[model samples]
Target: MNYAYLSSLFRKQTGKSITAYKNELLIEQAIDIFKKSNKNITEVSNKLGFSNPYYFSRVFKRVTGVSPSVYLSQIYRN
Candidate 1:
């Protein structure tokens, strides 16, 4: 019925907070964008509504276990 209750239910169901879930989804999108386009990390971060590229990089690393630059390098290397 309320935001906190819904958030609690979501966490119980998904084992992650809403913010974590959102960051994960955003990172997934970032990967897709990286693979499909020539957009740089800053561009992708802005497209995904991150406040800044640095914060986006932090969240991206937190979700994917690598920085955006490293992820891009890995993606292109494979």
Candidate 2:
């Protein structure tokens, strides 16, 4: 891999850069799976390679301002 050349390719037009973009992607996908899956927290965490459910819940809540179960409940009621 040409590290320098690839690095230049990912220098975001908005100045956020590639790492930030990838993080946004991860957080976005997490929400997608959370809403779509009937899987439990541990399953979501494991599926997403989050190491543990506690940390997964923490990150999910941080991004969406609610627990995964709570989030799922809202969707289910609608």
Candidate 3:
């Protein structure tokens, strides 16, 4: 469950560290859930292993340039 060296190994391969790669993947999943699933913000946050909705929202917005609710609304309205 712990991958301290994967960062170095992945960085050596793709020039992107594990932390960055993992965060990118996590953010992508969050977007999928927000746009394609019935899960609420809190539920998606918990399912993604985030500490809480606030923390998840912070990270989600930081990565996607928008809030989870706003993203979800865009999908829902479309």
Q: Pick by TM-score: which candidate is best?
A: 1
For model 2, state the Cα shift of residue 75 in Å: 1.1
Query: Runs in model 1 with CA error above 4 Å?
Result: none
CA shift of 39, model 1, Å: 0.7
Provide the lDDT at 40 for model 3. Answer: 94
Q: Model 1, residue 72: what's the lDDT?
A: 89
Poorest 10 consecutive residues by lDDT, candidate 1? 68-77
Which candidate number has the best lDDT?
Answer: 1
What would the TM-score be for candidate 3 when compared with the true structure? 0.75
Specify the poorest-scoring 10-residue window by lDDT in model 3: 1-10
Model 2 stretches with alpha carbons more than 4 Å out: 1-23
Ranking by TM-score: 1, 3, 2
Q: Alpha carbon lDDT of residue 60, candidate 2?
A: 77
C-alpha-based local distance difference test score of model 1: 0.96
